[model samples]
Target: MRALIAIDWGTSSLRGARLSVTGQVLESREFARGILTVPPGQFEAVFNELFGDWMAAPHALCLISGMAGSRQGWQEAPYCPCPAGFAELGQHLLWLQADRIALVPGLSCMNPDTLNTPDVMRGEEVQLFGALQLAERNTATLVLPGTHSKWVQVEHGRVTRFSTFMTGEVYALLSQHSILGKTLDLNGTFDETAFLQGVDQSQQAGSVLNKVFAVRTLGLFERLSAAVLPSYLSGLLIGEELRHQNVPPAQGPVILIGSDALTLRYTLALRHLGIACQSRGAEATWAGLHALATKLTNKP
Candidate 1:
C-alpha cells in the first residue's frame, strides 16, 4: 500500500488526494459536503459512489479533517485541549473505523469559570500545521479567511493558542440573508481606498464594535450606500484585527490560507496597517491533506 491519503471534507465540499510515500496530491477534487446531499445512513455509500469512480485501491489509510468529524459527518471526533503537543495528539487520537481511518482532532480552549466563552475550531488547525510543515518551523502564526475566520499560533509543533472571528459569516448574513442583501454582493476585487478608510477608522479610539450598527443606520439615513456596506463591514473587521489583535511582528511568520479574493482582502488589510506579511502554500486544503496523510503513515 502507498501508506496515506488525505481527506478534507468540509461543510460544503469533499476533497481527497492519493499520495505516494512522499506527500503529493495524486488526485484531489471537490464534491458535495452537505449532509442533506449525501444523507446520514448512506455516507459511505455516497463517498464510495463519488470517489469510487477513480479509486485504484482503498487508500492504505486516510486521515480526514473538518466537518467530516462533526455530528453530521461520518463520525464525531473529540476536541483536544490546547498546549497540545505532538505526543499528546499521538496518544489522544480518535479512530472512526478501526486503524484504517482516523481523524485529527479539532482543538478547544477556555477560561473555566470567569468567561464561560470557549474558543472552538474545526478544520483550520490541520491547515495551520501544514503551513508549519512547509515553513519547517517550530513556531508560526497563520490566518485563514472565510465565514468564520481563524488566527492560530503554534509553538514547538503544538497549537498553543488561537482565536476566531465571525467576520465572514457576519458579512454573508447581513449582506445576503439580512435586509442589506439588496445592496451589495461584494464579488469585486478588494478596494484599496475603502479598506484603508476602514483601517483609519479602527485607530481613531472609540470601541470599533459600536460601528456595526452604522451599516444599517447609514443605509437608512442615505449616509452610506447599501451596496458598499459589505465592503465596509469587511474593512471594519479586518481593521480591528490589524489594530487590536495583540500579535507582534517578531512572532515568527504569518501564513494566510483562503481563496485568492479573501486573501487579497487580508493582504490589503495588512498593508493598510503597515504589518509585514507573507503568503504561504498556494493550495492549503491539498497541502493540508498531504500533511495528514504523511503524519499518519510516519506514525509507528
Candidate 2:
C-alpha cells in the first residue's frame, strides 16, 4: 500500500506523480522528453532524473502508462483487446526492471466502421479508466481531446468501443501548412463569437473541405479578423468531428477529460450543438494508475 510512482509518458511529454494508496498525489513533475525524445535504453535514466528525488526506497513501484509501453518505448507492452477493464489491464501489465516497474498495456478494438481494421490507444486508456471512475458511471461516452481526439464508449465498467478523430492534427496542418496557413495568426486570441459562428456554420450544408475556404474569404472581406480566425477554425473542425460522430444528444453529458484549453473549445462546441458535457482534470490519469497499482500489489 506504499505510494506508487505513476507516469503518463506520451509522444510529446512525460507527466509523473507520486500517489498514496488512497490515490492522493503527494508530488508531481513534468518533463519535455517524451518517448520520441528518450534515447534508446535511457528511459530509466530519464525517469530517474525527473523523479529520483521521490524514489524514497527500492520497494516503491513505478507504474507507467502511455507511449512508454509503445514499440519504440522502453518496452513493447502488447495491446489488450477490448472489452477491457482494470482486471484485464492488470492481467497484462508488463514488468520492466523486475517487479519494481511496470507498463500498462494499451487497448485495441476493431474499428466500428471497418469491422476488421484495428484501432489502438496507449496512454488514453488510463485516462478513460480514471474518467470512468471519477464519473462513477458504469456506462457513458467519454471524449478526450488533443492532437488526436477520442470518443470512447464504456459499458458495465469495460470499454466497449471507441473512435479517434484527427481534429487537432487537421487544424494544425491546415493552419500551418495548407493554403489557409497564410492568413492565420498563431498568436491571436480566442474569439467566442467567431468560434460560435464556425460552429453554426458546421451545422449548415457544405463539406468541411469546402467550408474552410471561407476563412480566406472572410479574412479577405475583413469580416473575420486574424485574431479570431483561429478560434473559428477550431470550432469548424471540432464541430465537424462531432457532427460526423453523430453521437445522439440522449447519451447524456459526455464526460470530457483533458487540458482546460482543449476541453474548453470542445465544451463550447458541444454545448452550442445542444449536447450535455461534464469535465474532469488530467488527474484522472493518476487516479487510474493508482487503481491499477493497487490491483497489482494486492494480487497473489
Candidate 3:
C-alpha cells in the first residue's frame, strides 16, 4: 500500500504524519521549525531527521502546507485564488524534490493591484476542507484562530473568500511585548463587562488599538482585572468581525477550529452578538494532514 505523508510546517514547528490511503494514521512526529531556532539553512536535514524512520517505507507521496513552502523552505509556491476547491490546491503544487514530494500553495485573497492588500493562508486550507467534510455539506463557515485569525467561508466544497483579523498577534504584541505589555497582569482573565465596553469602543473608533489600553486602565483603577482580559479581547475581535456583516448570512452556524480556550472565547462573543457559534475544537492537524495527503495521492 502506498503511504501518504502530510506536513503542516508552520512558523515555529513542523508536524508530519503518515497515513493509509483510507486516511488512517500510521505514524506522526513533530520537529522544531523556527527558521531561526533550527539549523541556519538545513530544513531538509531537520525534516529528514524528524521523519527518517517513517521515510524508509513503501511508495511515498508527500503534500506539505504552511511555512515549508515559504521563502525559506524547500520552495515557495504561489497562492491560489479564492473560490478554490480540492483540485484548486492541485494547481498550486510546488515540487519539493520529485514525484515523492509536493507542497500545496497557500490561499490568497484581495486584489493585489492598486495595493488594495492581500491575505494568504497556508496550512488552514486542509482544516477548512476537513471541517466541511465532517459537515458533509455544500456550504460551511469556519473560523481558524491563531496568531492571525481568519474567518473562512466555504461553499460548494470550495473556499470562496475570507477575512483575516490580526487580532491575536496584535493582542500578543500589545499585551506582552510592547510598551503596553508592561501594564498587563500575569494572571489576568477575561472581563465580560469590559469586553462589551471595549467592543463598543473598538466599533466606534478609528484604529482597533485606539482604546485597547482602557482595559488596563479600568483594571488599575480597581474597576477591573482577570475576568476582563478575555472578554475585552473577545469584544475587540467581535467588533472587528461585525464589520464584515454588511449583509448577514441567513444566520447559519459558525464552526470554530482551534485551541479550546480561544475558540470558546470566540463562541462566547458571537453568542453575545446573538449569533450562534459552535466550537469544533482544534481540527486534528495530523488528521487534516492525512486528508490532504490522501487527496493528493488520488487514493481511495
Candidate 4:
C-alpha cells in the first residue's frame, strides 16, 4: 500500500495530509495561502515548498480536492454533474506535472428548489462522500455549514442533489458592515437565550428584511443589549436559512459536518427547529480522499 498525499485546497487556505494506505494520517501540513492568493503558474512552487520534504518517492500519489481545481485555481478540473460517485469523479481527475499529482473534480446539480439554476460544490463533495462512508448509510441528508453552507441529499451512494446557502457570509457582512454593526458588540459572550429568541423570531410572520431591522431597533430600544446582538444576529441568519431552505424533517438525524464552532450553532438551530441532527468532525474529508485514492489506484 503506497502512502498518499491528500490536499484540501480552498479559497483562503490549504491543508495537506500524508496518509498510510489504510487512511491513517501519518503527517499533516497547512498553509495560509489559498488559490486566490497563489500567483498564476506558482501552484507547483507553493506545493513543493509545502510538501517537498515528504514527497518521498517519484510514484507517490498526490490527490487534491477543492478550489485548486476551479477555473481560477491551479488547473480547472471541470465539474462532474450530479448523480456522481467516486467512480464518476475518478474518471475526471486532472493530472498535473506528469501523472503524479491529480486534482479532483467538483460536483454540480440542477437546483431542485430553484428552476433552471444550477448549484455546484468543490471540496465538499469529498467530505460528503466521506460522510456517506463513515455513516454507512444508503440515504442521508448532509448539512455542511460554512461561508456558503450546503444542504446535500445522497441516495444509493451517489449525490443526487444539493443546495447552497450564503448564511455565514451574509452574517459576517451584516455584523461587520451594516447599520446593525453600529450598535452591536461582536466580542460579547454567546448568549443561547438571545440566540434562540432570534431562531424563534425567524418563524414569525414577516419578511426577513423586516425582521433584521429589529436587530437595530431592539438594540436602540435597549430591549436587546449590544453584548448579545452578535449571537442574536447569528441565530436569526441561521434560522432564516433553515426556514427558507426547507430543511426536511429528519428521516434520520441530519449529518452535520464541519468545525466545532459552526456545527455547534447549526446543531442548536436544527434542534430548535425540531430537526434531529448529529455532529461529525471534518475528518470526513480524509476518509473521502482515501476512498477516491483507492478507487483511482485500483483502476486499470
Q: TM-scores for all candidates?
A: 0.86, 0.95, 0.85, 0.96
Against the unseen true structure, what C-alpha lDDT does each candidate score?
A: 0.70, 0.88, 0.70, 0.89
Over 1-300, each residue of candidate 4 has an lDDT whose tens digit, in order, gives 467899999999999999999999998888899998999999999999889877866579889999999999999999999888778998888999556789999999997557858999999999988888888876888999999999998878888899898989999999999999998998999999999999999888888888888899999999999999999988888898888755556558899999999999989989888888888886899989998888877878
Measured over all alpha carbons after superposition, the RMSD of each candidate to the real structure, in angstroms, is 2.9, 1.6, 3.1, 1.4
The sequence of per-residue lDDT tens digits that candidate 1 reaches over residues 1-300 is 345667777788777776666676676667766554667778778767776554446556767778777777777788888877556555555786677667777788773443656888877877777767776776777788788888887777888777788878776776668655655546655556656666677667788557655666766787656556667777876777666566667875467887788888887888666665666644565565566555555777
Task: State the weakest 10-residue window (summed lDDT) of model 1.
Answer: 51-60
Better of 1 and 2 by TM-score: 2
Worst lDDT window (10 residues) for model 3? Answer: 242-251
Candidate 3 regions exceeding 4 Å error are 39-41, 111-115, 190-207, 226-231, 246-248, 281-284
- Clash tally, candidates in order: 0, 0, 8, 0
The positional error of residue 260 in candidate 3, measured at the CA in angstroms, is 0.9
Model 3 TM-score relative to the real fold: 0.85
Better of 2 and 4 by TM-score: 4
Displacement of residue 124 (Cα, Å) in model 1 is 1.0
Candidate 4's error at 292, in angstroms? 0.7
Residue range 55-102, candidate 2, lDDT tens digits: 766588888999999999999999999999889999899998678788
Ranking the candidates on TM-score from highest down gives: 4, 2, 1, 3
- Candidate No. with top lDDT: 4
The candidates, ranked best first by lDDT, are 4, 2, 3, 1
